[model samples]
Target: MANELTISGRIVSVLPLQTGTSKSGHSWQKQEYILDTGGQYPKKVCFSLFGDSITKFPLQVGQDVTVSIDIESREWNNKWYTEVRAWNVTYASQQPQLQAQPPVAQPVPPQPQPAPQPQATGELPF
Candidate 1:
């Protein structure tokens, strides 16, 4: 909901929580995690959960989960940075999980080709 991007994958890494204070004297905490979408060409995405929600995400490496995140990009000092901010996290659904079936498309069987017959050279040399 609300233009959120949801992705499902197994947790590959969980970085330690980071705590800091804002310039306005407000404390903040953030936790980052990496998820791997296993397939022929596996992809890994790093996302972070901020604020009190960090405690809600008790994810561990090798656990399958679906996460809702917002992609953000900002420019600072003429440099651009991108962030994937996670808002919601839950266990992947039980129905037809990504790991339950093959990721690659099914192989197609080759069709039989006709063999070429020998050419009659010099009447087959009788």
Candidate 2:
């Protein structure tokens, strides 16, 4: 869409799923997740997936992804509310695997030797 925006980050949390039947007798589902833009000053954004999109993008915590979102606001009961809705989700990149390194041998320190005891004298002196 013309107003769509894209953001890339790691999934910080997955909120509880919400399900209900609409007034027109149709069932709907909504799922929300938090994304953290990692940098010097990280920012957290909460976005939602609706209906089949929830299953289409089975997001998980710690998974890196780029999401296309639409920002919209509505007024209800004289108050305005805004929502960040995600339309597309793609994996950013696979995390790099760390390889194991060979262990280094440590040097052992030498133990100290004990001093010899003095011999006992036989004669008693007064």
TM-score per prediction, in order, is: 0.69, 0.72
Task: Give the clash count for model 1.
Answer: 0
Across 30-66, the per-residue lDDT of candidate 1 in tens digits comes to 9999999888889999999999788777777778888
Runs in model 2 deviating more than 4 A are 95-126
Q: Which candidate leads in TM-score?
A: 2
C-alpha root-mean-square deviation, each candidate: 15.6, 12.4
Which stretches in model 1 have alpha-carbon errors above 4 Å? 93-126
Q: Which candidate number has the best lDDT?
A: 2
Lowest summed-lDDT stretch of 10 residues in model 1?
A: 93-102
Clashing pairs in 1: none
| Clash count per candidate | 0, 0
